[model samples]
Target chain A: MATTTMAAALGSGLRRAMEDDPRVVLLGEDIGRLGGVFRVTDGLQRDFGADRVMDTPLAEAGIMGVAVGLAYRGFRPVVEIQFDGFVYPALDQMVTQVGRLHYRTGGTVRMPVTIRIPYGGGIGAVEHHSESPEAYFAHTPGLRVVSCATPQDAHTMIRQAIACDDPVVFFEPKRRYWVKGSVEDEVLDDALPLDRARVVVEGTDVTLVAYGPLVVTARDAALAAADDGLSIEVIDLRSLSPLDLDTVETSVRKTGRLVVTHEAQRSGGLGAEIAASITERCFSLLHAAPVRVTGFDVPYPPAKLEEHFLPDLDRLLDAVDQVMGRQHSLTGWSA
Target chain B: MLRSDVSDGRALPTTEEPPDPELVQLLAPDGTRRADPVYDAWVEDVDAERLLSLYEDMVVARRFDVEAVALQRQGQLGLWPPLLGQEAAQIGSARALRPDDFVFTSYRENGVAYCRGAAPVDLVRVWRGNALAGWDPWAIGMATPQVMIGAQTLHATGYALGCAKDGVDSVAVAYFGDGATSKGDVHEAMVFASSFAAPVVFFCQNNQWAISEPVGLQSRHPLADRALGYGIPSVRVDGNDVLAVMAATRVALDRARRGEGPSFIEAVTYRMGPHTTSDDPTRYADPEVREQWAAQDPIVRVEQHLHTRGALSEDRAQEVKEHAEAFAMELRDATYGMTAPEPLTVFDHVLVQPSAELERQRSQYAAYLAMFEGTSGGDE
Candidate 1:
């Protein structure tokens, strides 16, 4: 075992995937000579050659359409959009072609295309670079959407997503890419399936559901709540589309209080679906209605305002406090 | 008018860029065979028997189009995009391809699909709303026809790129129309194909119209000229002349197979019928102009050429027509007999392994369906 960042873990996973399957290929802009803007695919081109690690033209639709075609011809393509905001150009190809081909062809054509997007705000980048666009992909029916919180999950899930026969939209939390953690070289066979949710920090008073960049914040919030004699459970939802509602329901059944959180706009976001679904499933067992701590229903704010916009530990604890019927942390940027 | 050249009865409009005088023409509209030093050698092996077979292919394709349109009109099909007057362009180029060469085409390439060995019933499976997929693409080496305009061009480029990486010599061919050249996907496809030197053939049958829009709106010059901007060689062929189309396709296929990168072909043709069964060509196309194009019919020119050469007898042509009629009748029967698929089958192919959410929904749907089963029948 060696300590590594989420980015390095992803690189190792990609290397392992390519080493195991000759049919696995990578396509993205600047991925060949530049590794990647975030360096998640660093040194891959030097080892795998330019043909396997392709530096595609600066066209997202072209990259996506080409990836779908590669999948059509029995190649598993792992494509990278430079950032989450730029994925819009390829959304049509993903939703219309990549997602539908398998369904359209009645299971004969499998779209084993893994699209990686460095998403969520953390780096002090410009407007388009740090946006969270998971809701768009999660709403798309044919795609399997996922997000990795820790380096270990990132390492394991990246390979699993590449090997999956269906198209997967993988969201990498940009904020956590460089956060270092210990990782094992060999993945255990008993590792959780790519779509299951895991409880990162367990407690009893309330269950706090989070994913991607906000999982760490939820964990921190749970730790903080423990100091005050309040127990909070933090659940890291790995898959966003086929939500592991059974695990969540079990946690909610124990806690009887729920809080859902994300960095996207609260309106029509994954939080709304989680809150409504949890309410419907565990209504009789609940003590209070599920509270959603999410970003505002507006465009992702500028860099200076992002810290306030993003769900921090204090803000998440506020939602947990509200569900626990305790004195809450004030809910605003000033707090 | 489908094109600005409707009044002149020519395929290209009189723009700042005129039609290339070097347009490959082995057979003119008047049934005169012209010998070209460059392309004539490509078609030398097209003997009288092969020519007759090519003519029969076009004849049968035209029959299929006529029958599909009739089926749509009779409500047996949801919609049909008629490939009228472009039979030679589709069949001629498709016949030039080896079975291993994959084809990515727009929804209008039923003729190419047929040549790729798609069954007649499979062609209408999607149109009849019976199934999401009509046939297995792997079995035919052709993808399910793409409906998003010009998108398949990118797929062709991508597939060829993969083939190059795998060291496969087989080429990927993209079939689209004049208006599709205006799409960003086509431009991106050419750029990628050229930049990577991927073995791709962009076979564009410029049918002079995109629904109601004229080709002039899509291009100021001949569509073939646009290929030069991307560092790819191009050819403009008489789409009505089956031999000319075959020669052009052979040249492109040869270039692609030789690892010389991509090539483009603009098969200039006209749409003699409505864009689909729902369209009314009379709304925009003038009768006199349509008559002028009718004189240059792709199948008619082949028939005239065969008659002038005495290569095929009238009895032989009649037999082929009878054969096509019998196939059309079979198509009608197959279409009428197609049963509606099970309602629950919609959830079958969404994923290789159904997710937990999908599984719950499928079971709930099954239970809901089960609710109606025993309550309805006296036999129960």
Candidate 2:
């Protein structure tokens, strides 16, 4: 086992997949010579020749459309969208073609295209660079949307996403790319499926469901809650589409309280869906209504205001305290 | 509308930027054979028997289009995009392709689909709303017609790129209309195909109108000239002439297989019918222009050429007519007899593996559907 950053682990995972299968190919802008904007695909082109690791023109639609075509021809193509906001150019292809081809063809064909996007904020980036667009892909059917908060999950999930027969939208939290953890070289046979949620830090008083970047923030909130004698369970939801509601529901049922956290807008985000599903399934077990700590409904603001815009540990604890029937974190601040 | 001079009866420059002035004609509308200096060398392989076969193909395709339109009118199909005047362009290029060569086309490529060996029953499966796409792409080597304009060009380019990587000599062909050239996807495809030297053939059937918008609105110059800007070799062929289209496609395919990168062919055809069953071409196209193009009817010109050569005798014409009628009748029967698919089949292929959310919804839907079985519309 080697300790590595999330970016390095992703590169190693891609390298492992490409080594195992000759049909595995990588295509993206600046992926060949530059590794990647975040270097998530570092040294791949050198080892796997220029043909397999293609540095395409700066066109997301072309990248995605070609990936779909490559998938049609029995090649597993892993594509990288440079940033979260830049993925919109390829959304038409993602939603209409990649998402519908299998279902539209009625199971005869499969789309094994894995699109990797470095998403979310806290790197103090400019407009279009630091934005969370996971909701857009999670809402799209026929696409397996996933996010990894740890290096181990990033390493395992990327290969799992590539091995999957359906198309997957893999979102890597850009700010957390440098967060390091140990990754086993050989994935265990009983490793968790790519779509399930795992309880990172277990407790009993309240349940904190989070994914991607917010998982870290949620853990910090849990640790702070522990100091106050309120046990908080932190569940890292790996899959956003299939949602792994069973793990979340089981945890929420045991805790009898729930607080969903995400970096996306409050309305119609994954938090909303999780809250709704939890309320429907665990209605009798709940001690309080599920609360959410999420990004504001406005556009991902300029870098100066982004710190205030994103969900923080304080914001998460505030939501947790509210669900626990405690006094408001900020006593008359809103008013 | 004749952008270039046909003074020599060989060159007709439609675009301002002329890579080659000739439109590459093999047979003219006047039942005369016209040879091109470049494309004639390519069509030498096309014998009398091949010409007759192409004529039969066009005749069958036109019949299929007519039948599909009638079916749509009778409410058998949800919609139909008729490839009326563009049969020669579709059939001619498609016939040039080997069965292994994959095809990615726009929704208006029923003729190409037929040429790719999609059964008549499979053809209308999507239009009948029985399935999303009629045939399996892996079996036919042709993807389902992409409804998003010009997007298939990128897919074709990408597939061709994969072919190059796999060391496969097979080529990918992208079929789109003139209006699709204005799309970013087309431009991006061209750029990548040129940059990577991917073995892709961009076949643009310039059927003149994208619904109500004329080709003139999309391009100031001929669409073929745009290919030159991307450093790809291009050809402008008489789309109504089957031999010319075949020659152009053959040349492009040869170049692609020889690792000569990508080539573009602009087949200047016209859409004689409405864009789809929902369209009214009369609203946009002038009658006089339509009449002028109608004079250059693809199948009629082929028949005239064969007659001038004393090859299309009365018996031959009767045989072709019988073949077309039989094929059309078979298609009509198959379409009318196609039963409605089960309602729950909609949730069948949403993912390769079963999705829990979709599974839950499917069971809920099954329960809902089951509830209706003995309800008797709540009349009791």
Estimated TM-score for each candidate: 0.96, 0.96
Residue B256, candidate 2: Cα error in Å is 0.2
Q: Would you list the clashing residue pairs of candidate 2?
A: none
Q: Which stretches of candidate 2 lie over 4 Å from their true place?
A: A332-335, B1-22, B378-380
User: Model 2: per-residue lDDT, tens digit, B47-90?
Assistant: 77789999999999999889999999999999999999999999
Clashing pairs in 1: none
- Computed on C-alpha atoms, the DockQ of candidate 2 is 0.84
**Chain B TM-score list for all models:** 0.93, 0.94
Q: Weakest 10 consecutive residues, lDDT, candidate 1 chain B? A: B12-21
Stretches of candidate 1 off by over 4 Å are: A327-335, B1-22, B374-380
- Candidate 1 lDDT score at position B184: 93
Candidate lDDT values, in order: 0.88, 0.89
